[model samples]
Target: MLPLIDGKVVDITGPGRTDRFGVTCTDLGASIIAPNGKLVSVFGDTFSGRRVGQGDWRSPVVLIGMGDANHEIVYEYAGGSDPAYARQLWDYIHDDAASGWRRGGISTVIPSDLLRVGGSLYLHAIVNHGFGDVIWTEIWRSDDSGVSWTHLGEQAKFPADLHDGFAQCWSWDFDPDDGWVYVVATGFQRDKGIILMRVRPDQIGQRSQYSSWGFTDGRWQWGQQATPITPPDEHWGELTLRRTAPGKWVLGGFLASSYALGYRVVSSPVANMYTTPVQTPIVGSSGSQVAQLYGGYLLPGSRFGVTGGVGVVVSQWRTDTGWPYRAMQFKAKLKDTSKTPRTPDPVNL
Candidate 1:
């Protein structure tokens, strides 16, 4: 397996407008692999016929998937009116690549991390009533894929007070070893560090069943008070956590201030989550210069049965480029630190 080094990060979407489909100014592109081996992705705040950072088109969410020819829209949640005014309306979008994206049944909440465990599909999303006003993290379940959904109620919320500053739960993954869904969350202020939480797969809908990771008396423990697993100075935006291979876990996200995509590796889910990570520059002037890049997440499936190296999807905004909110794919190689004495220094690609 090739080690992840400072190399060129390419824009897979290519050049021009037709190459860019769906809504503009869309971000937080979270993805999940379907049973049919298709890479299905869900995006937040999509604007139809608009450029990145442009005025809102009132599209709250949109779904797309990788097809044999190209990426096609799977579904889109466009209300009769602006989503800001019709905050109470909850809808669903279905995945039908054969006929293109079609409207599906309705639900009470929007979706973030779309995960499937056993026969049921789980959706993790921010519960917002006002425009850009986040309420809390809500979980929903669907038995017949994305056709229908049932609200599972609030899975987590920011504390009434800002003592811990833990607010929105962003990304998650299921761990087969313990049958738990581990979640990574951060604050709404965008300055607080990241926090970790987990719930049993069966008890995912119950708020009380969820537990936070805590470090007390020089030991790591769950079910205690929540604390920042990352450094106090670093603020994380959208994040993804998943098992790349047996006993190998990878966490990836964008540094809010730097706008640089970075990742951390560990032997197990609960092991050394707080340690500093090796960063690769994706989109910044001093960094990789990919420009306006955010929401860097590892794709669900592996390529060629090689878990050491995988594909990562990052959102390239219109900050520098004229095009806003384009999804770009990059190749990432995970390094085996067991053979090395210490974690390698950050590399600027």
Candidate 2:
């Protein structure tokens, strides 16, 4: 198995576009590579101009741009009425009347992660009951890239108590090799361990079709009750488990306990993450370049094997002053320590 030995930060993405995008005070950039070869990104809790009346402060908006917009996050306003601003996914979900928080009634239905399956884009979003409390999660889809969406509805909605709430937040990828969508999920608010699950791409809307990996009877079982892939060593926040290509995987996210973005080069979902070490390439700090870091979404150009490196999109929010709350891109240099190459599992998740 190819394990990441070490890594380094490459650069911040979008240049001045963080300011140019007009949506300041945003966090959690969950993205996917669209069929048109564009990097379609979604952000949570956005603020543009005002906070009420559908003018500004939109929760969960979409931004379409080139994956390699290292120079500037050039945008295409194909999803919004305004030809100049990024597209806000939901207009009905506006700021509350009193505190003006929770862009959708008492809570913001925020985007957790995004994935492209077949010709459509699917997004996993959390419905909140309060701070650190999730009521449920639903998957939404869009056929015309990020322009619009249709929710999978009540039948497909995942309850917050599902798997003891570990299924509240998710990051997933489609594996064409076996036609299964491998999912790695955790609780919101960074309070739980990671769990691995798999569902067919077509059956993603059906909760009964999902199967989880757990260590039971002294061996790994694909259809067993869900178990944390990582021991309760630390609290994990907003995770990203992506297959850069088939059979190639890298998993990481906000390590809430350490206040840093950490990752592991996982060979597979069932490849024993309990013992594998996590590498922290970017550390969060108050005086350093990155502060209050979270949301480690792997961009399109990220590589998995040798010549390893990941261009990840990370979010920074200054708790003291929320002005610097935005998403930036950083490349992590990877070190491989594999003595011999590994092959894909003939039988799958």
Candidate 3:
């Protein structure tokens, strides 16, 4: 299922202030695709390292994944506050993969999407407190892989019958046919475009077992509530939604008024997400003439066995000069019209 060819942008974090690892600009740079395939990125504020116009807001929180044996682990968040004023968890190590990554020893959890399943690892976080008030999304459970974590507090919220305030929890996967674990949230002022829940990889931390994904009358039910499988003009922001092969699935994100980086493969993520997808253009959109994209993660080994190429790990918001939120790496190629024919909208549930 590797097809995505639009290839060219390769900068894998660097230039946001000479970058070496002190990431600049900041944004939810979630990524995951390890287990030997490599590509673990995770970021959300590194502006203190300076370079996006000089730096001063030290709210460090970065990690690059793959430690313990495969080596190459670059963690950060050495207790400088801002996990909502310190939830404790410090680890700042940097062996010079570029003078920019540190923070690897302590973590109260801030990762967003890390999946492992069977042997257990799962992260998919958000539990905030650092200035945004107190966001939610939570779900942490390590068996020993990520060292230690157990907070399984809030798994899915913000469905106040369909929306009333906040929600966060973007990107998730683990649908071996139907075993569950779908996720892909939105709301928190995103206007409302994406939604779909699932849960059952052993009750993913049990939020009453999780369900959502309803539509009524036209069909496609589940528990009968959640909607917008992405259509309200599609304003989703930092997304990922996996499953690239057995029935395809895709999703990808960043379309807040055409800021570019779009995608939508669908064969079933509950099918029909309003078709008409496949739009690149990052680096600040306007058709990405180059320079201003933002977190478009898609690497999980590109999904299904080798077939063409498809890596994605975008976030080039450097804005003015040379380093602001750097972390680029592209290798697209899946455009044979992406296969076309997606029809399935009337499920009998």
lDDT of 1 by residue, 112-191 (tens): 56776777767667654343345456666656544345677544443323225574646777778777888777754456
For model 3, residues 1-349, the per-residue Cα lDDT tens digits are: 2224454444544443224344544545565544434334555545545455355333224343432211222343221233222222234232222334234322222445667666565666554433222345556665644434566655433232333332464678887877887887774344557778787898877777778887878776788677777666667667787786777777766776677777776666776666546555333223555457656777655532232255666666655664546655565544533457655444641
Which residue pairs collide, candidate 2? none
Give a tens-digit lDDT track for model 2, residues 1-349: 1233223233332335543555645777777778777778888877764222223666677878765412224555434554456556755554344655645554677888888888899989887755677778889888887778888777679989888888888999887888888899999978788899999888888888899988787767889889898868777888888776555677878888777777777656666564557777643222454756788777665654433355667877667655566677665555432223455433333
List runs of model 3 lying over 4 Å from the truth. 1-24, 29-45, 52-92, 97-179, 182-199, 203-239, 242-250, 253-260, 265-277, 281-294, 297-314, 317-322, 326-349
For each candidate, C-alpha RMSD in Å?
Answer: 9.0, 5.2, 17.3
Query: What's the CA error at residue 133 for candidate 3, in Å?
Result: 35
Worst ten in a row by lDDT for model 2:
1-10
In model 3, state the lDDT of residue 110: 42
What Cα-based lDDT does every candidate model obtain?
Answer: 0.56, 0.70, 0.54
Q: Pick the candidate with the highest lDDT.
A: 2
Give TM per candidate: 0.72, 0.84, 0.33
